[model samples]
Target: MKVTFPHMGNMSIVIKALLKELNIEFIPPPPITKRTLSLGVQHAPESACLPLKINIGNFLEAAEKGADTVLMAGGIGPCRFGYYNQVQREILNDLGVNLNMIVLEPPDNHIGELLKRLRTLTGSNSWWRVVKAIRFAFAKCEALDDLERAASRIRCRELQRGDVDRVYAQGCQAIDQATTPKEIVQCRDEYLTKMRSLPLDHLKRPIRIGIVGEIYTLLEPSSNGFMEKNLGRLGAEVSRSIYLSEWVNEHLLKGLLPVKGHKLTRKRAQPYLNCMVGGHGQESIGATIEYAQQGYDGVIQVGPLTCMPEIVAQSIMPNVEKDFHIPVLTIYVDEQTGEAGLMTRLEAFVDMLERRKRIQVESGLQG
Candidate 1:
């Protein structure tokens, strides 16, 4: 079966590597293009999240390319992602695609049972073979993660104020075509080297911002008006929390791994959440706390226009803001998102943080 997976920023490259290392024949949908957006916008309901639309476009493109099966991740709780596979699957069926769509649910959902069904796709039978797959997957993740971290630095120059998209495009294309872990490592090094060679140290740091939220809006530039990229242009070092490895670690072992007989983040974040609040709750709180502890100027909660898990986080964020004193901004992105609106809000937020810092410094001197 020729397998394909949906887009999730740079994660697609690593996932594509995982399938290849398994010796599974697979094809990736092309990069996000106006055509992809047009196809998605034409067929999807008007009110769906922008991410869902872009992905439908990705899947439809893959289907048109003769991919017989598509691989996707499943979700839980009140998140609409929990039902995305079902809806998108039916949409493709209505279009006469007759495609075999695979939704790999979280490990707690018994991923092994699903893996058994697709074992032939991996071309591995020995227990050691599965172990090997795990090792290779980790290597791919590490390489891809490092590469994106570097690209994140350069994207500031490329998409922000400087015009280096040609080089950025070269790096992104390198990632898209990377077939081996070693190749990924090379791409990562090249991206970092290119970024460091630029003339960027003259700009002052704006309010340092950390963005965390639903997977789709976080990754899709069109959905958020490239908010993080815009933040970089505003002279902030944008830190986003979502990557292929983090997702794999979350699904595979982070929750199950014991730290003094319980999950570390859950145990550590208890003062924050007494129980499982569900769907990235532990992460959102933990990352904010970490950023606050690390002295980040601010944190921005990004989510889909109607995302529930983020709404849950939003409910408790006041305490985080009160307790940590970190200026927190929430941006709910949708199709109607205007570039001008986002720019204004971000500028205002950054200005507030700068003023707050000055007030604190002046008060300290007076005391």
Candidate 2:
């Protein structure tokens, strides 16, 4: 059975590694584009969030490429994401697509069920082989995150625009091709050194900006209009609140291991929001506070239009800005979100941040 899955930043890399080890043939959905979004928009409910619509488009594209099975992650929360798999499945059935969809839920208290699902997918592959594949794939993901973090740090400092991005892309490509953990480490280090050695404009002081919001929009560039790279190009260093491996380590393995479960972040949010508003809402508030205390110039909260959790976070952000003395910009994206408009807003935000920094320096309030 050929398998397929939605794209979420570097997640496809890990999925590929796993399927290859299991000796399973898989069809990866094509990259996100205008046509992909169009296809999704044509069929999805008008009120559905952008990520869900894009997912439907992804599965349709894969189905066209001869994929018969889809692999998706399941959720349980007040967020609409919890019902996405079932809704999408029903939608596909209505469209007469004969694909079998598999949903992998977090093993919160269902370790035995999770293992049974794994066995079904892996067929007769020994548990040892499956475990080894997961380790290798996870190593690749961790290495990629390191590369991404380095890129974010250096993007605004590079003497030449896009130089850091170019190196970062090459590093990701190398990691994706590396077969062994040693080689993965080599890829990360070799490219990291290269990134550090690139010429930098030391005279330029970049505005420090933290990004906080829904996981899908934060991780998926196409959904967020490539906000991180665009902000860096506008002379801001971007720090994201979430990454793939960290999510898996905390949520996916929570049942199997002892995880802190972002205790510090939750603690920071206690003053403003103490309960789970679902779908990273509390985390977004916590992360913004964390960034403010760290002296960041500003924070941008991005998410899909009509997301209730993000709406709640957005409502509370004015308080965060007032209490922390940091600027906050909320951008809610949909099929109609224009890249030009998004860039314009980012430019204005960065300009304001720079002016604020200048004032602080002149008044002897900042070093």
Highest-lDDT candidate: 2
Model 2 C-alpha lDDT per residue in residues 1-367, reported as the tens digit of each score:
9999998998888888888878989999999888889989988999999999999999999999999999998888799998899999999999999889888877767666666677768898998898788778888888888988888877889888889989999999999889888999999999999999999887877889999999999999889999989888888999999878877766665524343356688789888888888898989999999999999999999999999998998998899999999899999999999889999999999999999999988889644
The residue pairs that clash in candidate 1, if any, are: none
Q: Count of backbone clashes for each model?
A: 0, 0
C-alpha local distance difference test of each model? 0.71, 0.88
Deviation of model 1 at 258, angstroms: 12
Question: Model 2 reaches what TM-score against the true structure?
Answer: 0.96
Error of 1 at 220 (Å): 3.6
lDDT of 1: 0.71
Model 1: per-residue lDDT, tens digit, 99-141? 7877766755564754664564566456567656655666666
229 Cα displacement, candidate 2 (Å): 0.7
Clashing pairs in 2: none
